[model samples]
Target chain A: MRRMSWFNATSLTLGFVFLYLPMLILVIFSFNASKLVTIWAGFSTKWYGELMRNEAFLDAAWVTAKVAVASSTLATVLGTMAALVLVRAGRFPGRTLFSGMIYAPLVMPEVITGLSLLLLFIGIGLDRGVLTIVLAHTTFSMCYVSVVVSSRLVTFDDSLEEAALDLGCSRLEAFLLVTLPIIAPAVISGWLLAFTLSLDDLVIASFTAGPSATTLPIKVFSAVRLGVSPEINALSTIMITIVAVGVITASLVSKRAAVKRRNEEQAAGRA
Target chain B: MRKFALIALPYTWLVLLFFVPFLIVLKISLSDLALARPPYAPQLDLSAGWQGIKDFFGGLDFENFIWLTTDDLYWKAYLSSLKIAVISTLLTLMVGYPMAYGMAKAPEEWRPAMMMLVILPFSTSFLIRVYSWMGILSTEGYLNQFLLGLGLISEPLMILNTPVAVYIGIVYTYLPFMILPIYAALDKLDGSLLEAAEDLGCSRFTAFWLVTFPLSRSGMIAGCFLVFIPALGEFVIPSLLGGSETLMIGKVLYEEFFNNRDWPVASAVAVVLLLILIIPIVLFQRNQQKEREAGQ
Candidate 1:
């Protein structure tokens, strides 16, 4: 038993190291004083300073932020509506096709999707640019949001909506007043998922984006082709920290809600 | 009746935008290469008429398909891509499985923290993660510098701009993808079964092999397919780390489409790539259905 426990601990520690050692090294070397990329002469904040002042990176960052926000918002709305429809409506003639179409982008290679969309846009004479990027991003991102929202919706009790309708509320009013509030958490999570996906996208963005429509991923990819710099490291570290904080906060809040619900049920049972 | 339209709206949008585009690609892939003109026109020539129809039906050429199969370059690219993808998927599994198993067995409080660590990397730009590798693995990069500083080597190891670099890039980029699904699977694994095996006087190794391994196979398979399929078709990492020497199908397709201006050949390659990807996807779907049926 002691031997087994030791083995388990060793395996776990090794896993943690494998997952994080590269990232830890990345964060450490971001502050490396040398510009040669390999030599760690000492620590410095010069890279972060350089990143702040880099005009092209700054512009790309701005573009990425806008695209993430806009596409995520669009995806959330469309996806939430789609999820509500899929979950609430009875089995229809095209239900399988609808579900398959929604999830198809999830598995399709990004290159194929990007190329096909690029072809479509060109065929229609719509120049590739920010609009096309957003459109492409939204197309895939909506699938993710729909999957998340639909899974959440599956656990939802239909009686809540039925109860509201019974209490003289119209279907729309019942959805807004009851169903919407219940699924708000799923919607928020779906939105965040969409935002992260849009921010992280590269391949699809590469195909759809024009010269003036570079995102942060595109900017970094182009820059690395020339040669890597510590400035890129600095940018990555900041982005990782922000995402880590968001995920941690969201998980904690959700866990607490679960705990609260369990406690409430226990109390009601005792009463 | 009104709600029907509301539901129909989103489905219609997806069919028109998403499904139609794929159908367009399929149509283009089937059309003659000669008919491909600027502004994206796929013309059907009836001059050859019945012979062309017979050729199409009989699979006389499949011109593009035949080109892809007969060409040495295409076959080499496909083989290289398969080799890289398989090796990387195995490496990811070897590294990721132990970690996911460990996380699954950890204290509940620590599980969330550990899972966060895995997922946190994904939130950042994937291109940056790949770029970060360039800094670490390059001859003048930190790894060589650190090793050289320690007198571990007389000369910097030539690691970058090779197939090894491509492997490193794919593993690093897709590690989280492998971890998340496996972690989820392991987390949901019933501990009582392991306890039962131990109670039955089974050794720890036997217990895990008998109980945990089988249970986690789905996640393992899912993770492997996820990593392997993308790695096979990946263009970016190969383009970046592969330098000039590496021949990857994704890069080949990219050149065909963008550089060579051979849209028909590009379409052919895409079709073949899609066919390759579909095999794993079908197997995955079958496994999922079996699991669902067993659950019911």
Candidate 2:
């Protein structure tokens, strides 16, 4: 038993090291004053300063932010509706095909999807640019958002909407007044997920994006191919910090919400 | 009325934008390559006319499909991609399972922290992570530096710009993918069953093999497919680390479409890849449906 515990602890520690040590090193070297990625001379914020000064990097970052916001917002709206239909609508002809179509992009190789879309755009006389990137991003992003929202919808009790309807409210009113409020959290979470996916995507973006429409991931990818740089590390560190903050905040908010609900139930019981 | 429109609108958008493009690719794949044009026009049977009443067999050729099978280059790349994907997936499973098991056994408070550690790296740019491997595996990079510092080697090993580098890059990027699903599965595992096994005469290894491993098979399968399929289609990692000598299908397809400007050939290559991937895709979807049904 003791031997088993030791083995488990060792293996787990090794696993953690495997997963993290490289990231830790990258973060550390981001602050290194040396230009060479391997040799760390001394700690400095000069690479970050260089990143701020570089107009190309800033432009790419701005493009990425815009794409994430635009694509994710559109995805959230479309996905919510798709989820509603999938979960609430009665049997309809071709429902299986619709479901398959919605989820197909999730598993289909991004390269194939990108290639197919690129071909379609050319066939339609559409140029490869930001518009193409946004359209492509929206395609897969909506699927993810729908999956998240529909999963949340599955747990929702139909009785709440039905009760509102029973009180002489129209179906639309009931949905707006009851169902919409209940699933609002799901919509927001789905949007966040969509945003992150859009921001992180590279392959599809590479295929769809024109020279003028370089997103941050594509920029970083090209830079990495040329050679590793401290500036890229600086950029990575900043991005990691942002994602970590978002995740931590989301967890805390959810935990707080759970506690508030529990306390309200207790108060109601006492009353 | 508004609700009906709301639901109908998105489905229409998906059909027009998503499904149409795929249909176009399928159509083009079946058509003969248009010679002497930048955008190769797909061969069409105008003899069928507007009504399109004709034999389905007469419309398209399986020449592209035949080419994919007979062509030595295509077969070689496909085989190499399969071999790499399988080996890397197996390595990921071996490494990930123990870590997931340990995470599952950790104190409740620690589980979230561990999960965060795993997912945090994922949230960062994948490009950077793959790039980071370059710095580590390069001839004069950290791994060589550390080894040289330790007097482990007289000269820096030539690890970069090889198939081994491609393998390392792939395995590094995909390890988290294998870890997360397995961890989720093990996290939801019932402790009582393991306790029962222990109470009975089962040893720890026997109990894990008989009880935990079988129970976590779904997660294992999910993780493997997720890693394997994507790894097979991977372009960036191999492009960056595999150097010029290594030839994977994704890179080949990219060169065909962009460099050589051969859309028909690229489409043919893609059709072949889709065929190879169809089995895993079906299996994954079926497993997901089963899970959903079981959940409900």
Residues B101-148, candidate 1, lDDT per residue (tens digit)?
777777767777777778777676677677777877889777788899
- The candidates' DockQ values read 0.53, 0.61
Q: Taking the tens digit of each residue's C-alpha lDDT, what string does model 2 give over B54-139?
A: 43435567777788778798899989989888888898899889888888877777777888888777776777778777888889
Worst 10 contiguous positions by lDDT, candidate 1 chain A = A1-10
Candidate 1, fnat value? 0.52
- Stretches off by above 4 angstroms in model 1 are A1-4, A260-271, B32-61, B150-152, B188-192, B199-201
Model 1, position A27, has a per-residue lDDT of 88
What residue runs in model 2 are displaced by over 4 Å at the alpha carbon? A1-4, B1-3, B35-38, B43-59, B289-296
TM-score of each: 0.91, 0.93
Query: Residue B86's C-alpha lDDT in candidate 1?
Result: 95
> Which pairs of residues clash in candidate 1, taking residues 3 or more apart in a chain or in different chains?
A38-B141, A38-B142
Clashing residue pairs for model 2 = none
Candidate 1, lDDT over the whole model: 0.82
Give lDDT: candidate 1, residue B269: 83
* Candidate 1 structure quality by residue, lDDT tens digits, A1-271: 1233676689777766655667777888888998876666898999999999999999999999999999999989889888887787878888899889887788888888887787678767788788889988888998999999999999999999999999999988998999988898899999999999999998889878988789998888777788777888899889878877888888889889889889998999999
